[model samples]
Target: MIAVILMLSRGSHSRSHKLKSRALICSVLLWMSTAVMTRSSSTSDLKSKISGVEELLEEFRKQLQQDESGSREDEEDGDRCISGFKAAEERIIRASASIEQGAAFLSAPQRVFSWRDCAHACCSHPHCTAAIIQEDLKQPDDSLRCYLFNCTYRGRSVCSFSFQPGFSTYSRVNNSSRPHEPGRGSTATDSPSLDEPPRSDAGQDLVVQLPTDWAVLDGRDSTDDHDIIHYEWALVKGDPSVKMKVTHPGLLKLSGLREGIYTFELTVTDTSGQKSSDNVSVSVLAPAPNAEGQKLFVYIFLDYF
Candidate 1:
């Protein structure tokens, strides 16, 4: 009975050790599975982020390419304009008198391989009457600035200054269309000098009240011979060819006006029935957001007064 009891104890101890060994193995396998899953999740997240960044980079590159292509198309179209002159042939005016001032608009410095390239750019633009090439001595040989200008009635293309070093001006001369002076040039047009249209104070922007306003249109004769006896006011910009109602003595009372841009044309007639016209632009601004409150205050004050 004692030996049998000892044998039973040994069997129980062995069974407990085997059970503990199985539990340890199960724990190690679970830990390894968790670590592998975590690694795989981390790698997947990294790959996703990298893919998003690449897509964004590709989109940015496409946008840049589109912009560059549009710019190239604009350059090819040759839509550049200077000084309101168009389709005029470029004539090289070497060491011309006008320097410095007189440019209606000055363009930013453009890179030109040679002087001829600058001239070609000027000629291609419809508004470019003259171009001045300025050399940038500090930069490379291709660095040049192109200045555009409109030829004033006076002989001065730019300013009265003398020739400047490292600068040359090229002017657009319209031989086919320009009216030739009788004494100054070989051929002369049939139009007489006296028949030149009278000058008026127009081409200026104006602002006025909405719904109702008083305006004045005055006409003056350049000859000052009291010959400008007739005046007419017309609308050219707003509502298209509408005529303005005229009060006596060149006073214009504008009424029924909405918020918009309006252009008024004035033509004055001399005794010889010669008419000269000018245009003025008027802009009607929209009422401010606080206009109603201010208007109520004004009405109250006016009633009290």
Candidate 2:
């Protein structure tokens, strides 16, 4: 009986040890499976984030390319105007200078940030053959002021140079254009060379019939070495009721005339602002009776006799 009891107790102990070993193995397997699943999920999330970053980088690259292309186009446009122009150092003109007799401003003075910008402005204008730029010491950015002009007197370039502090002059280089010759001993104090004024020709006086109430005043023969830019007509002594119309520059049409003497003065200005004046007279006479009407009246009187 004692041996049988011992055998039963040993068997129970062996069975309990086998169950505990199986439980330990199952716990290890569960832990390893959970660890593998967690690692895989983390790897998928990392790949998604990497894809997002790559897409953003591509967009940024495309934007950068577009910006570069636009910048290149802007540079090309700016180059078109400033390419054939050259600048003269330390030579410019003042607004109040006596140079106004031989030159006229192409436009109002413009404020710019650099001399290059001023030069570009001058080149852009069709009539601008020269330009002057001066730095403004009062401005915080040290900005520049630009003045554009054709600088011609009697069809010749009157662009003379003188010493001016913080000033530069720019002129176009063209085979057809004349070179600007600086005057000898030209200084800030000396007066610039002057040119002859334009000549105005309000053509020969006219005689018109009273039935014809209109006259055409011709000033097309006005003479200027530089081109004529403006023509002004005034009724110095005429019928105040007369109407004057400018058909074009240096040409005028007069209307509302009567049997009287009408006098007009033509003042012509050239590109260099030099002007000359001349006068013309138009005499409107009473119209003669119609010859046919007089003959008809004579026939009617003969029939009455």
Report clashes for each candidate as comma-separated counts: 5, 4
Clashing pairs in 1: 82-127, 82-128, 85-126, 85-127, 86-126
For residues 1-305, write the lDDT of model 2, one tens digit per residue: 34544444455556677576556556666777788888988998999999999999999999999999888866765664465567788887554442444555667455698877887777566556677887788988777888886665555656666887788888775411222222232222353443446778899999999799999999999888657889999998878999889998878999889998988999999887878889999999999899999999999999999
lDDT of 1 by residue, 57-163 (tens): 99999999999988876554432222223322333333244322323342543777655666666655433556667777777665777665544322233433234
What is the model-wide C-alpha lDDT for candidate 2? 0.74
The alpha-carbon deviation from the true structure for residue 148 of candidate 1, after best TM-score superposition, in angstroms, is: 4.0
Using TM-score as the measure, the top candidate is: 2
The lDDT per prediction is 0.55, 0.74
The stretch of ten residues in a row with the least summed lDDT in candidate 2 is 175-184
TM-scores, all candidates, are: 0.34, 0.44
